[model samples]
Target: MNKNIILIGFMGTGKSSLGRRLARRLGYKFVDTDSAIEEITGKTVEQIFRKDGEIRFRSEEKLLVRKLSGQSGLVVATGGGMVLEQENVDLLKQNGVLICLRAEPEVILKRVKNKKRRPLLSRGDLLENIIKLTKERESAYEIADFSVDTSRLTFDEVLNQIRKFLQQEGYIK
Candidate 1:
């Protein structure tokens, strides 16, 4: 059975927060792809987007995903747009149980509004952008093995849902 768990969803769906917690509970190392990108480039994701644009960032992401997807025993928190690339999705599936975290656009916006690192959300019309992007990404997210609506769930609640999924899937006994 695959020991890695990969979380994918729209931005502000609590992937980062939940990744850290889930990793701790399960004794796995957590990797947030965005943070890894920042570390490798020595710049924040916003800086990457500003200097290299989304295309460049995505190419870099593809390379990184190719490498990271081969690793085991990790809890990976993926960027919101990771699934836009079929290659990334296939790579992640090679050794990971992909789970989608979902939440309402209003909830997502409220959770992310204070964060300065979100390049895409920095543009005008935050709410509309959330709606648009989430709609566009719905199919990508729907391919997950399981999805949990986190709009009103607490961290523990979300974790509980994930734990249940893992148990049911026989990833955990």
Candidate 2:
């Protein structure tokens, strides 16, 4: 498929993992926006958040989103807040299908609690933060072309669901 497969979701929703698997399965290049930003800025995501702050990080993300939106044959795993801006969403959809991955708040906490990598979740109550952020992004996530809840689903199962949607949409055979 020439069109990009764009994965958007809250953190810890398996975007990177599933994007890599889908890219390999479809023989497409895989790009994680966070990693791309890190590469460009010469810093980890946490460093960017802690040092440069979210606004500066988002500026970098917006630039990368514009770049990725012009390409084809890609499986893009976008950062959790990338679509918060309408411009990012419009640009990404121009040459791609936006697939949102979702999970329960508790599931999200279970998935990311051990990792200190998530800057937004580093604040007070982890579960409360997840719920608040998820709620805040609900509208943006709703604009996705397709959505899959990864909660309680195996990796293979979630992948299959995504694949089935792509097939039905004629993105894959």
Candidate lDDT values, in order: 0.92, 0.95
Point out where model 2 deviates above 4 Å. none
TM-score of each: 0.97, 0.98
For model 1, residues 1-173, the per-residue Cα lDDT tens digits are 45699999999999999999999998889999999988988988998899989998998799899989778889999999999999998999989899999999999999998988889889889999999999999998988999999999989999999999999998876
Q: What's the lDDT of the predicted structure labeled candidate 1? A: 0.92
Q: Which digits, one per residue and each the tens of the lDDT, describe model 2 over residues 1-173?
A: 38899999999999999899999988999999999999999999999999989999999999999898889999999999999999999999999999999999999999999998899989899999999999999999999999999999988898899999999999888
Best model per lDDT? 2
Lowest lDDT block of 10, candidate 1: 1-10
Query: What is the overall TM-score of model 1 with all chains considered together?
Result: 0.97
- Provide the RMSD of all predictions against the true structure, rounded to 1 decimal: 0.9, 0.8
Instruction: Give me candidate 2's TM-score against the actual structure.
Output: 0.98
Candidate 1 residue pairs in clash (backbone atoms < 3 Å): none
